[model samples]
Target chain A: MNTMEAMLASLPDQYRWAADLTSPSLRAATGALVCGMGGSGIAGDVAGDVAAGAPVFVRKGYGIPGWAERLRPLVVAVSYSGNTEETLSGVEAADRAGLAIAAVSSGGALSRLARDHGWPLVEVPGGLQPRAAFGYLTGAVMRILESAGLVGETGLVEAATVTDELLGADLDGPGRRLADDLAEGLAGRITLIVASGSAAAAAYRWKTQINENAKSPAFTTTIPETDHNEIVGWSTLGSAIRRTVGVVALRDTHEPPRVAARFEPTLGRLSEGASLVGEVWAQGEHPLARIASLCVIGDMVSLRLARNAAVDPVPVEAIEVLKRELGET
Target chain B: MNTMEAMLASLPDQYRWAADLTSPSLRAATGALVCGMGGSGIAGDVAGDVAAGAPVFVRKGYGIPGWAERLRPLVVAVSYSGNTEETLSGVEAADRAGLAIAAVSSGGALSRLARDHGWPLVEVPGGLQPRAAFGYLTGAVMRILESAGLVGETGLVEAATVTDELLGADLDGPGRRLADDLAEGLAGRITLIVASGSAAAAAYRWKTQINENAKSPAFTTTIPETDHNEIVGWSTLGSAIRRTVGVVALRDTHEPPRVAARFEPTLGRLSEGASLVGEVWAQGEHPLARIASLCVIGDMVSLRLARNAAVDPVPVEAIEVLKRELGET
Candidate 1:
């Protein structure tokens, strides 16, 4: 358990390396598709947010659509073990269709296939479970996107540096005392995550973690998108809305000024009925670092939430049962 | 209200004509992608399921993935108004990449673009809301897929016939007893829909309808897939499982005999502490009809469930708020 904690602590740094290495490859691709199943696909969500010029599609299924055969797009098939059947099928389809392909895996059939096919391979260091390797997967995707010329390399580096600093600073540190303050506000209330632009992916991650970790119902919505639709739903909740807690992930960059301006007012309106907690994150010099930092923070928060809820942070029995029954083992 | 009901009743016949006319065009394309949003996208799901030889992908976003473009796949951009921004964007992306394109619409910007670009156009009849014109959309997709030569034509004819029989025999007829039976089993229970193969799409449709119409939390999982995962999650609930209801959709021809055999035993074990109901549907001679019939049945079941719950079937105030806040409207 101590070793696991140490590894978890070192994740942010290793992720930065992964992101830096893959950046060059992403800059060269004409177009890219990220194929994975379940949690692994979350990396694609992050990539989509920061990708420069190339269009990216996240494919999740057993077989590639026939149309996929014709496009011959650059492909990144991601499976933590390199053996997800759906992802394998995607890689096979991509190969059969003669598309440029890359593989991201710790070790599995996908890694073997990548070796055999001589496809570009980004090897994630082994040991950690797929979900725990979020930093590596996310960083690798950003690097790949960068290398393929789909996004700028500068933003990714800057983001990584900022992420490192944030993690190192630890708002829960003695002087800052942030965690206790935030926890006090969150106590006994449901957390609602609201974000805009690229931060939307992090917001979703936060929501899912709170649900699965804290075993509580949580919700997330993207700005601009939510500003248009969900704002009205808040009007109907009335008094019961007081039980809701709002977490707004504020990014200094990415969001348009008009959108950024709406954040305070939106929170202020909801604050009338719900408790509001704001966490502002500055984008790192590198987009990859910036995204990874948010993810790391969200993961920590979720773990802390789990501790507060008196539950184990790892091993979701419900999901495990489903996987076992599926003959995944 | 009576006139609206009359119009709704004429939906099946209108759909048949549209199916027959458009089927030939789809028979020759190599591979196909169906692009649409929300209600219209459901048609793509049915089309993809029934398609025989060639694979079909339902694209539901602003642009096609880079890899999809390289495949040079045939594209069917669907928008009821012929002007959905996302679908139009997909069409433009497909055009820029030089894919064979077709349009399914009721005289909107997409139709004009199709005409101007000289792409094959299947104009669905006008005067109905997109959701109300599901039959037309489903048929049009089937026709396009058939014309592209991605799927067999016979299935299309057979499915359409089944749709006609189902509408005439059970849902529209006075002597029909299926609705009352389903209503009795579904009342006061959290319904779960389960199915296999093409029927899975119908199951999903049922789940969504129940959610939107009944204003209740209902869930769905595909068979074989669920046999692997969700079956295990049932063990923890104990007696609370009795409040849950299972509805299995069985299709005669498509499901493998082995899979069909497992349905009863699986449901038997899972529902040991719960209520289980089975509905056997014999698919029509045409793939289009078979899908349409199931869709119609699912919609009616959902509507009936909503009525039983004493909720309005059409209006979704929460979703409305979401849309308004997202600025989707």
Candidate 2:
């Protein structure tokens, strides 16, 4: 396996360990904020979902939002290498604001800051690229939020164990077999990912991965919501464009009954011209595991799709150029 | 002036009056949720800026996010005619979730539901198109959220009063005169709206107006977050795309100094070939006026831009056709 595949292969086990290892922080925080860049920011997004009551805001840039200054949030700065400039800038802003601050990093400037300032830190294992460390970062954030009392403990240990078992059981085996199916179904087509509830995040991730990894344009919209607006847009597309569209439904057990009821009918309506693919996530003992499993599966599918497209799964030249022009270097 | 112009003319006064009338409502809510369709959604976007301690989520579709379902939130559903199917669906969902729900409508299913269900309802006068009821919808949602104990009362009364005075204020009135200048700067460009802190809401409103009224493609992003990822994307754009971009910075006094400080330098560095326009919203007596004025001004500029684009200011044909094809009629 290539590096990404190797990382993917080990992800389920690593994520379970990470989830079990980290302790939840105390929840006495007045407010909460997340500071990270790129894939690390995805952890914050998941954290925001799980800790919805904590007013979690993701800091992707050097400057904090104006209102953040007055809120005096509990800041969690995340960096895979512990040295991202944007994340460090957020840490500095938190310091200036006198906000309670923490750090999640392997070892870098952020780690040093955490050590020197005596701020609580979650030490992730180094070696993997930032994207490859997604499982670790996301699990760590969940542990911290849970410990902080920002979210209820949802039997995460059991969930992680179940996820580990599922991964070892070759759940992705089907996904790989399905890859050729997807390529055949999606050839010369635009993919639209439709997800509901918590699945919206995963759907968005899939869209991004498809765009970056598969080097194809993809759009994503949440269920019920898209049933109203975006669904309308698809029906109006000329037959030529309509024939070039594919719909992928990412379903999880957590979806409400009403959402499931709406899903089939909606998909049936849209499937008139577009190809439809349904990928159901395996159930886990914990919501965390279930979420992680789907995410990993998505990453794998996106990568395989890239292979089918005869494109490199990693390098995003357009995004790189955009970043370079933005003077991120 | 056409009906839209006449309605726009009256907005400043209406906003000021509504601000005073709804101060208590604005003061009570812990946070705000703005629910509406199309232009009405713009109200929530503007309110997001002025409402302290309230993170506003604008719901433009049929159902709320699954995370929202768990919150059992206080949601203000705005539908000018009180009959928008999407808003009605959202209202029904919120009601079923036992959320604190309110309605802003002239008369229709929403008003009837509010009345029959004993839900709080703000009756905006009918006759005007939803797009033309910007001031009323904006004022009403803010007031309701405030009344429900979701946000603070600061600037509520003052903003309303100032908006009233400005209604009669000439188009060339000092701050309002920039309509022409902004239009000129934005001509033949994809206007990107940027704001931080309390101004972020206004920036979003500006973008929507540019999309719906200007009938052109536009985008909005908040500061700090955009600086990290989106900033990098700018550098990758070819010269043709870069020159076709324009930046509109929405400023308010309430922004943190650090956030305000990063504005100029970030824009200078990020917008290489783009023209930039700055619109500063004067802190009026009420937060309502402070937000409404920016919204109204943006609407005017967008309408002018639409004229320049040689597109009708109303009627989204593509969207309409899409809805029809989906059997939404």
Candidate 3:
């Protein structure tokens, strides 16, 4: 199995470990901001989806939002390698602004800062790509928030069992079958993913996975927002777009009915004569299970696309090149 | 002048009328949510950019965020034609939740609902596509927020004069000269815009304009964040992307120094061998002028592109079809 699959299979353990983690007692705050970059940051987006009691936002930039000060939100600095410059800068800026701040990382300057400054820190296991280690990061964050009385533990225990079952049933299974079909339909084409609410996070994961894993062009739009603008692009681009596009709609049982209603009409309007149009509904009963279920299915599809393209799915040499170039600037 | 040019030239007047108009007093609220879709929703994004004391968010889904109950944010429903189903549904949901609600539209069920329910309504001018009425919508929303004491009236007055001057400048002038350069450099190529802060809004405007006006593929990514995932696309897709993609960076004097720091490193990392790489620095000293300045230049680029593609820059038949489809469903 590849690193991603292994990571997916081990999610239950990751969650258990994260929930058992110990950190300093966190101060109360009106809101929370997750300062992270790339895959590490996406965990925050998922947390924000269900963090209904307090405002939970992911800040991908160097500082908090302007209004963030008055709310005195809990700022969580997250970096997988604990080396992301943006998150580092954000933590320092938050500290300078006297905001309540915490850290989550494998190990690096962030851990050092947490130790020296007496901030609460969750030290996760090291040596994994930020993207592959999403389960650990997300679980740790929920626990971090729970420490401050912001989250609960009742919703996600069954996610791993459902995901593991779906992952194991690969011989003519629904998910693998869908993945195989998508591989054939979307090969060498630009993909557009439309999704809403909790499913929007899966849509983003699919887009980025397709881009990195298959080396293909992919874009994601949230509905009904895209219904307003991108639908116009479909009308104007016409045949050129239809010839090279694959449209995927990610649906969840928990989403508003309006989401499905909009999807049927949008697909009817734009998917005709296009390369492919498909849908994947959530698999399990739990919200986290359903969200992860859709994302794992997308992860498989991207892996299949990579296999078809004869490219390895695990390497991100391009990221290394960018880091080297960025180091100079 | 073409349809887009006429609309661009008229933005100043649109802002004036939107600002000067009177509406019913809106109830006080802690935060604000702009409930809109497509171009109308973009107005909320601009307001959020400048909303200092309180949090301003753009909601594009069927109902408000779950946390809205605790926040008790002001919900302002905006649909240019006054008939967006999502906005209509959202307003009803907002009302049912006992949230402070207002309306902005020309005339439709929303206006009627406002009148019947005694909600504040800002009647936008009719007979133009929603996207073309961004300035008026933005101004009206700002005014709506002002009435609720959520926004101060300190910035943005000079946007009209500066935009008017640029709109008036003819052949060989600074704005036109830049447009000519972009028109030549970007013809028949896919454009990818990289922008940050206030300029990010203009980047989105340019992206949608390019899609609808030129009927070509374009994507946008914010700075610092793109350094994480999209940089992998840049490295992996290298030659294929470079041969077809035009890269434009929208810069503003108001963007924090950290925003610029990320740009230099990212451009140094990604711009080599691309079809086009260029920058547009915002004009005028005020934030609104700079924001609108960058957007106006992008509008000019899209118009020039449409002229080259031999397509009319107005009318989106597909949107009408989707609405008709949704109405039946």
Candidate 4:
């Protein structure tokens, strides 16, 4: 097995490690502002979809939204390396605005800043790729939210249990099969992942996984919204160009009836012009479980695609070069 | 000139028509929630970037966010035809939650709803593509904000004037040249539009324009965020796949210093593997003008590319079919 395969296999353990972790001092707030970018940032997306009672806003950019300054929502700053520049900027902005903050990172500038500012910090293990550290990051986020009284404890435990049970079962069969199916038509064709509601989060995860792990181009357009513009293009695509594209629909059992209704017709229209690789259904009852299952499948498919293409999925050398050139390294 | 060309040429008039209009009775609010889908939704994006005093939240999906229901921000519902399902759902949600709304549309279900509910309404001219009515939609939004005492009148007038002056000075030169350059290399390659800060709105505009007008696949990744993930993929792209992609950097003068700093190295890293079709700078001193300039240029580029490809830009048969299939028409 390759490095990514090992990392994927370790997901259950990673979740177990932080599953029961909690912070007593974290304060409850009306809403949450999660600050992180790329891998660490995705934790916010997952949390936003799963969390109950309070709304969570994910900030993938440099700072908190201007209105959040006055609203003073709890800021959850996540950076696996504890040194991501955008997350650091967001934390600083939150601090300057006097918003309460909880930091999640291994050990870097973020942890140091948290220590200096006396903010609550959840430290994960170091040395793994940031994306590989997703389980830990999300575990830390959910625990923080729980400690702060934002979400109920039952859902969190069920979600963790569901993820563990589903992923722990022999990982090779389904994922490898899906990857083979995808890789067969993915070459020389762009992939479009269609989804709606909370499932949109998984669609994005699929697209990014394909881009980073498989080293291919992928795009996502959500439903009802896509019905307005993107559907037009998909409907009118010429045969040659249409044949050069593939579609992956992420379906959720929990979607609003209206949202679900659009999917079939949308997929049918798209299939007329492009190839429909297949559909991936959301698994488990809890929101977190459903998101996790789809994300894991996508992650495995990306690794398999990388293996098939004869490329290593372990290193993101390009990101390292850009960071070094920017003098961040 | 084709229908799209004539519509593109009328942008100046669209802005001029709504320049002096303002509603006096609209109530003031802490922030604004602009809801719409497709072309109409983009007005919210542009306004969110340009509006002053209160921050604007653009909701592209159905319904208002749960938090917004309590926060009670001013809701601006925009649909060129006033019949878009998502926008209608958003307006209905806002209404049920007792949130104030101002509607922008030519004539359709939205106009009727607004009248029945006695909500404020701005009627834009009918018979043009929703994307083609961008100037009018934005103008209506600015006027609503002005009347609600959310933003100042001076900035609104200045924005309209800037859009008019720049777009009126013969639309043939810069945009045509850029389109010729882009179309030369865009045939078989996918286009990636890169942007940062508020200019990210313009970048998305460029992507959708290329998708709807040129009927091609295009993707957008914002700066700072891209530095963390996408840069890695672009940097490690294999030669054959690398040659099949093109990049367009949308540069803005208003980007934060740190955001501006990352553009060069990021572009440098991407250009190594992908063809950099060149950069487009955001123009005009006002925020609205800058966004308008970039959008108009992209609009022209999309139309030109369609002409070169021998495809009509006006009909969105796919969307109409989906709507009819869904029984909305």
Candidate 5:
């Protein structure tokens, strides 16, 4: 199997590890900041979404908000390879601020820093692209929150079971069918993913995955919010949108009726401006399962799109070039 | 002056009013959720950015998070015309939960509901489109917070003076000159606005204004964060970006050294793909002044682009039609 496929198959293992794991006592902190970058940061977004009853903020840049000091946040530094420069800077800043810290990574600079500082560190079974290993990173963050008593236990194990069922179902199943259908509509157009509630974070995941894996332009924004601003950008694009843009609405049971009501009006407004409008409904009993299922569907669509374009999805050559160039300078 | 121009000129008035306002004794509230829609909603974004000592959450849609009841946030409902249906739904939900509430609007259904419940209400100055009245809505929300003691005194009055200085300067001035330059290059291309720190909120404002006024496709995202994701989309587009996309990066001296470091690297990654990459610096010493300056610059750019496109900047036919359609159904 390819790396992405293998990493996805190992998701159940990550959930199993998280379910049995014990955590050290965290300090008296009212909130938590899950510090990461790129894929690691996206996982933090998912963790924050499912981290019930806790104020979880995802920090992606070196600049932490001023409120962090006053909240005395439990800082969760997450870097899959343990080498993300931004996360390391954040760890140091959090330490200087005297905030409690937790670290998650494979053995690398972050692990060394955590060891040096005696912070709680969880090691992932490494050797996958950071985005591909999102399940483990996300599960580790959520597990740490649960064990630390900051959040209630998540239905991660159940979610993993649903994922397994999805894997077995293949082309005729919900996940693959949804992927093939969306890839057809979104093949050559800029996709705008609209979503709300817990699924909002997952909407962003879909956008980034399309950009990286499908090699296309995509955008995502939460609703009721998008209703106010971006919906107007549609009219401004005029006729060009008919050929260049498509809409993907991510829906879940949790969307309030009033928010749902806005969708029909949005469709009327976007009718001629968009090439197509599509929907993806998250299917699961728990919010965690729903979120994971939606993410997996999007990942598959991105893969399907890559297949359509006859491009190898694994090679992120431009990113590699940027990294090499950045290192030299 | 037209409503938008009057409101823009009266930016000083809003600040002056906010500086003098005294808030009623709000209940012991720790954090706040500022609920708003469209133009009214962007105000909440600004309030959250500068509400130094407190965490402000901006809820755009009806599906408030499940944790909201547990958080018991001091809910601030903002809708400039006081008639936004979604904001009213949110207000009702917040009230049902027995959360403390504050309402800001110009006599509409929301004002009536706020009065009936004995909750705090701030009346916006009447007679303007909700978007045009953003300055008044923004100031009222900030003033409400100050009055409630949720946040400390903002240098609002001082910031107004800077607006006066900007208004007095001619075409050779900071706002107009920057606008002319940007509109020149961004005349017929899709603009992607990139920003970080306090300037991030302003970036969204710029994007929306361009969409609504200039009638174009535009996007905004914060930095370091954007570096991790959207930068990949640049290369993925291959050469299409060279013909279709222009990037506008909003800069502020307040950005950290590490974040500032990424700009050069971003330009390098974008060099081959983008038609043009431009940077506009925040103009004043205070954070508020700097943010407002960037916004004014963007507002002017949108106007200039509208003139170039031979489109009237005021009418929003699609939005009006959508509102009428939603009301009927």
Candidate 6:
């Protein structure tokens, strides 16, 4: 298997190991404000879908939201490399607000900050691309929350089992089937992922993975909201433009009935002018497992698209150049 | 002038009337949760950028966020037509949470609900499309917050003056100039907007405007964050695909210095493969005015694109169809 494929295959092992890791100082809080960006940050989004009792909010910027201070939510700062500037800035902001803070990283500035400040830190394995290390990062995050009493242990254990079962299915099973369908449908087309409720986060993950792995432009719009504005745009699409678009609906069983009802008609409207339209249903009972199932397929599809286009999925040269220039600036 | 053009030009007058309107029942709260969808919901985002003291959180979903109950924020339900289902659901959620609630709409079910519940309602004039009434909606939202003591009266008053000054400049000035640039650069190419800090909301406004008014796909990515993953996508873009992408940077003076420094390198990287790369700086000193100026140009540009493409800027048939089908369901 290729590097991304191997990484995908290794997720169960990563999760198994990382799920057992926790920080000693971690404890329950009123709510959670997760701070990180890109691959490291996406776990916070996935965690929000499964986080029980306490509300979880993801911050993908330099600092926490203004309301976060008043909420006094536990600030969970996550950076896979432990050195992301934006995540560092966010942790500092949490410190200033006197909010409880935790850190999750391999061993970088974030870990150092955690040590210096005596904040709880959960360190995961390093040496993988941030995106490739998603399982480990998410595993560590869920463990932290579980340790804090925010997420119940039973639910997480069930989710981990479900995730393992889904990933361990036959080699040519659902994940491959969805990836095959996507590879054929999304070739040379910009992807438009329509999802709502918990699946919205997965749709965003699909968009970003397609962008980073396939090196293609993909956009996501949640339902009900998309029904209001973006649906209108489809009305005037020219055939040529439509031919360059591929629409995917990411569906979840947990969405409210009202949200679920709008998908069929919305998809019908979108399909009339697009190159292709397809649906991918979440697998497993647990929210985390279902979101994970959806994301794994997208990850596979992105890599397939990369292989099809003869592009390397590993090196993000533009990001490297940007970081280099940013260091100078 | 076209319908959208007339609406764009009349923003100053709309703001004048809306700024003076207030509801006496509104009072200060720990934070503000603004809920609505599409055009009406956008005001909440703009309000977030300018709101002082208390933080403003915009919800465009079916109900309030998971954390809103604990925040005990004042729920500002805004629906231009007063009948938006999502906004109604959100208000109900707010009521159940026993949080303070306020309403902004022209007239519809929302107004009736507000009257029945004795919730404070700031009623703006109806008739125009929701997007066209952005000034009225934003003004009402700002006024509601000001009256609630979440936002200061002086700052809002200053914002209004600055908005008027910026919008009242030379007829063929900055707004028109930027529109011309966008019309030239973005025509036929899918637009990609890059913005950060307070300007991110305006960038979203631009994306939705381009989608609905221009009937084209437009995507937005925030800075510092975009530098992480999205920048890499630009590296491997083939020339053919590159030619179909137009990149615009929506800039604000208020973005943190760290964020500001990354823009040049990011844009330089994006410019290498994009059809065209350009910058549109937000005008005026106040956050509200600056965001408004950026939005007005984008509004003008979307209309100009529609005129160029021989498409109508009004009447969203697809949205109407979805709503009708949803009702039948």
lDDT of 1: 0.62
* Interface DockQ per candidate: 0.12, 0.15, 0.52, 0.53, 0.51, 0.59
- List the candidate 4 regions with Cα displacement exceeding 4 Å: A173-176, A235-240, B153-170, B187-189, B235-240
Candidate 6 chain A worst ten-residue window by lDDT: A154-163
* Distance from true location, Cα of B181 in model 5, Å: 2.6
Q: Across residues A57-147, which tens digit of lDDT does each residue of candidate 6 receive?
A: 7888888777776678899999998988889889998999999998889898899999999998888888888998888888788877777
Lowest summed lDDT window (length 10), candidate 4 chain A? A154-163
Q: For model 6, how does the per-residue alpha-carbon lDDT over B158-223 read when each residue is reduced to its tens digit?
A: 455545654454335446766877788788767899998678889989988988898777888888
Q: For model 5, how big is the iRMS in angstroms?
A: 2.4
Between candidates 3 and 6, the one scoring higher on TM-score is 6
Which number leads on lDDT? 6
lDDT against the true structure, per candidate, is 0.62, 0.65, 0.75, 0.78, 0.75, 0.80
Report the Cα interface RMSD of each model, rounded to 1 decimal.
7.1, 7.0, 2.6, 2.6, 2.4, 2.2
Return the lDDT, model 6, position B35.
Answer: 96
- Give the range where candidate 5 chain B is weakest over 10 consecutive residues by summed lDDT: B166-175
Q: What is the lDDT of residue A34 in candidate 2?
A: 87
Every model's TM-score: 0.71, 0.71, 0.92, 0.94, 0.92, 0.95
lDDT of 4 by residue, A186-305 (tens): 754567889886777788788778778877667788987877766655544466657667888888889888889999989887787678888878777878778887788778777766
- What is candidate 6's CAPRI-style docking category based on DockQ? medium
- State the displacement of the C-alpha of residue A173, model 6, in Å, after optimal TM-score superposition: 3.7
Q: How far is candidate 4 from the true structure (C-alpha RMSD, Å)?
A: 2.3
lDDT at residue B30 of model 1 (Cα atoms):
56
User: Please, what are the lDDT tens digits per residue for candidate 5 over residues B138-172?
Assistant: 77887777766667766577667766666553333
- TM-score, candidate 5, is 0.92
**Per-chain TM-score of chain B, candidate 4?**
0.94
